[model samples]
Target: MSFLYFDNNATSRMDDEVLQAMLPYLQETYGNASSVQHKLGRAANTAIERARIDLADRLGSTPKEIYFTSGATESISTVLKGIAQAYNRKGKHIITCKTEHKAVLATCESLGKQGYEITYLDVDAQGNIDLEDLRKAIRADSILVSLMSANNETGVLHPIEKIANICQEKDVLFFCDATQHVGKLPIDLQEVAIDILCLSAHKFHGPKGIGALFIRRKSKPIQIPSLVTGGNQEHGLRGGTYAVPQIVGMGEAVKRFEFHSQIETIRDYFESELQQHIEEATVHARGTLRIPNTSNVLIKHVRSTELMTKVPEMALSSGSACVSGSRDPSHVLKAMGMDDEDVFCSSRFSFSKYTTNDDIDLAIQQIKRAVTQIREASPIWQMYKEGLI
Candidate 1:
């Protein structure tokens, strides 16, 4: 049986171009970027620098502002911990949303344990942050504000530009997690006025284990205590041997995605067609603005896990893969004011540039068939027929 992949939000398959770009570094140009005396070290360092330049160009930032990391998790951790440590003298307070990724939420939780004050701003029914609440949350002692550009589960786009403006006016540092939106949506740091941003390459068509963090040069430099203190890599912020091949792969991936206009068009087509053809399916569009490649649907009478179990050929998820094992409903949905039933019935289907229209059609058919079967067998549906649903 052929299988369809619709989980790009969780992770994307590596592109051939990116794989080819990484080949030399993995096989021949293998050397630690920290070793300065050897020719191999110079070659590895050159690849890393080139990759940084490519990523920075895509974000409309200078190469000097980018710092490499293992993934978005580490990038976020570094920013939260780094800024808190570096600027604690100024303030020991941070602000974030209740719906942020576990990486951000967990980091804030850890900081709270260490006596830092944290305020988690609430979201509206559409999963958008309240600017009024944000304004009220800001304090004289608030040093940093972290928010995501787009939600990983809901695909809801946040008001980063507005938030950044507020942060600027308030003279507080802003950090953005753009992991879900970087390649799928256009981002210009100059326009957004974000002080710091984080992204993981695997969310696009790049290999895993490589990501970047962007820090504004004008902001007071963070004397962030190192997370991995050792041989003075990544401007002495993160100290570890650089993974040259993965960095090269990420650079090539960004370059390709930056030029791919057709990807967005195809994604829109898939979303439009799926909404048109899937009758009675409550399509979750994540408010007015969202990344083009994602669509989360709540099939009213079917549990997401049960539906996926019946149709095993499609690669999809209920929500963030990080929270999959939990029996609790998606915190994102709860924050958006979705009831328990709607939350349990929802599933996420994400697309990629490589996905074909035929794949979309097939997946829809499979989904329709599965829902029909599940609803037919569901006691809840029977009760609904008796006016009890």
Candidate 2:
């Protein structure tokens, strides 16, 4: 059986156009961007600047504010650690929600061990943080507020505009880990007032090992202390040689980006079909604002691991790919008040531009069969059916 890919939230397939644009850089144009003495190096430098400008335009920032990094993980570390180090005299307090991606959470955890006061805001049942809770958490000594634009597991969207405004009112810098939000949605930094934003190109249709961080430079310019120190690259914010091909691919990906309005329709249809076929199957983060591509569904009493095992031809995940090897239940769902059993029973099926209605139809069919098979062997499922629990 030909395998179907529904794990786009983990990483998307690179676009053909993006790959074509990157070929020259990887082959003939293979000159170090920092080596500006030769013509080839000058050409490489010019391409990097062009890519930076294109990414900056799409992100609603200037070229000077864009800093390229390996990916969102590195970007998160740079922002959180740099901010803590640069602004330590102002305060040591930082705020973030419980449902953020592990990249932000881990960085915050490291900061906490270094004597930074980290305030973890709780989310409601639907995976939304209370704006009032955020408002109340702000302090005179609070230096930054870190939040993600969307949840990687549930696709739940936080009210970034309001959160940015709240942080702005409190005179705190706001950093958004937009790893899952950037290419899927339109992010106008000018309109949102976010102080810092980070995104990885592979989350879209670009190559891996390349991403960009956007810092606010216009009003109330803030300085983030350099995290990676060596050469004078990325305005001396991040140092090291640039990956020219990946950077070119990233630029092309952003240049060709067009939000697929049909993605939400396909996701909704998938959920509807799942609920219609699989008894007691329910969608997580339903009725909440989310990115169009993700659907986290709970198949009652059926472990997602078993379901995936039964349908080996379909690609899926229980939660973030960062912790896929871990046997632990999803931290995002646990934060949303779900029990560990139900969290294990849930699986995430994310789509991309390449996903189609027929693909979803086939996936639903396979899932229905898998759920039935799993539940047939599950004593818990049998007890639930008999109403004996």
Best by TM-score: 2
lDDT of 1 by residue, 332-387 (tens): 88888889998999998888877887887788788788888898898987796678
Runs in model 1 lying further than 4 Å from the true structure: 259-279
Model 1 vs. true fold: TM: 0.95
Overall lDDT per candidate, in order of appearance = 0.87, 0.92
| Number of clashes recorded per candidate | 0, 0
Candidate 1 residue 201 Cα shift, in angstroms, is 0.5
TM-score of each prediction: 0.95, 0.98
Off by over 4 Å in 2: none
Cα shift from native, residue 92, model 2 (Å): 0.9
RMSD of each: 1.7, 0.9
Poorest 10 consecutive residues by lDDT, candidate 2: 216-225
